[model samples]
Target: MQFENTLEFAQRLDKQDTLNSYRDHFLFPKVNEKQVIYFTGNSLGLQPKNAKKYVDEVMQDWEELAVEGHFYADKPWWDYHERLANPLSKIIGAKPSEITVMNTLTVNLHLLMVSFYRPKGKRYKIICEEKAFPSDQYMLQSQVRFHGYDPNDAIVEIKKRDGEHNFRIEDILDTITEVGEECALILIGGVNYYTGQVFDMKTITKAGHDIGAFVGWDLAHAAGNIKLELHDWDVDFASWCSYKYMNSGPGNASGCFIHERFHNQTEIPRFEGWWGTSRETRFLMKPQFEPMPNADAWQLSNAPILALAPYLASLELFDEVGMDALIKKRNLIVAYLEYILKEIDAQVESTFEIITPSNPKERGTQLSVFLHGEGKKLFEFLMKNGVITDWREPNVIRLAPAPFYCSFEDMFRFGQILKQGILEKNSELSS
Candidate 1:
């Protein structure tokens, strides 16, 4: 586990990496005809080489089969979503029957709230982390407004203590207790988008349940990045976008997981559509809506095959290697990245603080760096040098080395570029 900030050490690690072959599967961004080091998978994944092949198959089916493609094409449009269930289920730790691929992340969250966020008298407030992804904040505000309650009254945010970058687990549990019977739902990001902190979902779920509240997670940053056990954790419902760590391309189809207990609850409220009806009765076009016997019951429209093709392609890779292997490489790379950052800070006398948790169990592949004094200069320097990372407001750069395609050598090259950027800033200020 010893890490050295040297090209030889990084190259040696790359030589022994079992997942090194996966780098070739993706199309890395090129700058001036050279490949750029990409560290933005937590925002948008690189395109998989097989994604085109998968899209082509669907296009060919459309050209040849037309309307009949619904029945005759390979991986028929009628069941395209089903094709992803098994692999998707394994990735998120649920049964195929409990999982369904459909709309984007926020849309699914709204639909799920229709059923899981049923607010009875006094139990109408929702609890979540402060500074959740903007989409989540907007959704929560709108959902609360739709229910005829002011957001200030209906939304309880779990804020970090003064000057802390992440929320404390005890504080979260105590907040749940403080809310008590007023809490209708407890929803949070499985991984905080900005700080790269992974919340303790198992304990949080248990706390919510004990207080008679439904629990769910926005796994936009966690779903494929970290292994989850939604069913065993007794999570009532959850939704995630596949484009992040899943490497399913931008704006690809997302996934939903509903507890098996909700499958037979025909009385549950939902925004239903034809796609959610039973396959047997779908062709009948009957007036009565007979919802499917699984998570598909939440689907509001037909599958978007084109958008889903890339997801299937990526899931094939996940299925082949499994999460256990991916997570192992992810942890190793994260450690190496942390080591490199610390070494640069120690050697260069620069201010670079890692805001991401040091514990491997509390984070996935992301490391958020808080740069002081010459933050924007260093960021622009790295970008010009082709070291692509994500930047947030006020001076934090998020570098996420995706396990499927990023290599140990990438860490080495990134470290070198970062050091150069820091030195460049110093020279600029001195001049």
Candidate 2:
């Protein structure tokens, strides 16, 4: 799709968008009773219009059936989480047996670590990117200390080279090769949370497995935003929250995946609970823990039917639109945003630099912009004027134009707002 050099081009793209009607499916925030151009889906997606109905169904089940709802509601609360597996699996590119929707993201991360982070005598190290999200860093540190290992010695962080904005894939591979023998697991985000850079999961998984190490991904920023093939990539395990691009509400339940190879491996120890017990004997009140023999065995408690309903609604939409269509739309929209931003930068004196990669395959929906002089003030100005984007620490402002709901016109308007902010800064100094 060639974008013309006029605002009409963006309007035309919006008209031509196949998923344009999906915008009305979401409830965007309004200022003065008008919809705001929301670009913060990377942080909190706009709520779906049908979210209330989804929640109401579960509420009705609870009201009508009470305790009986677990066994025999319309959807059967006992197996509520299972109904999500097929659709969630399609979003993450995995089989039904390899995925399960359950606990929150950090909680699920800990559970997966308990089962995967088996640190043997000599090989007791973990490798992750240096600027990983704080929650992940804390979890990794606590896990290492819990096993009586010093995080300073046991954790290896791959950092960007000097004067570089992002880490090179080859450097990551080299780190794995150099420390492969000592590393027990490679747990990194599928997309770097701060930089908006997407890593090559297949290559990373292959490198880790070549050295007898487990590979997992924190897909918090990747799932539903990018096209993933976790099963094809042979990723050993992965976890992600649904609130972001999935458009589930904040603090929504998370999803986890375990490759089919581990389906029957009873030797691996997990922190088990009654909910993960075999379905056939769960009611027998048995003394021993007979796990459910799949990824569901990692589940810890009864499914939160209320929390899982929003995901069901969102995943159904994803199934209808499909990832291929979303990704194609995303590439064009993101490239348009990048092209306009570069044009503005060139017109000015190179005041803003895009930290995210220019290549569409290397990023999903977000573009992290680094302003030269005054980033925070500009961000605050945009927020007060109703252009919604996220500000990371120091100098980065992240804007994600979600393909499912955002329009090319939104990107065009964002460029105008950004240019106005920069020009305003110049005028204030001169005045």
Instruction: Please tell me which predicted candidate would have the highest lDDT against the true structure.
Output: 1
TM-score of each: 0.99, 0.98
Q: Tens digits of per-residue lDDT for model 2 on 1-431? A: 56654689999988989999999899888755666778899988888888888899899988998999888888898889998889888889999999988889999999999989999988999999987999999999999999999999999999899988988999999999999789999999999988899999999999999998999999999999998999999999999999999999999999999999988777787888888899999989899988887899999899998999888988888989999999989898889988888778876654788899888889999999998876588898888667888888889899899998898888887778777888898888889
**Per-residue lDDT of candidate 1, residues 299-357 (tens digit):** 98999999999999999999999999999999999999998888888867587888998
RMSD of each: 0.8, 1.2
Off by over 4 Å in 1: none
lDDT of 1 at 96: 94
**Residue 250 displacement (Å), model 2:** 0.3
- Steric overlap count per candidate: 0, 0
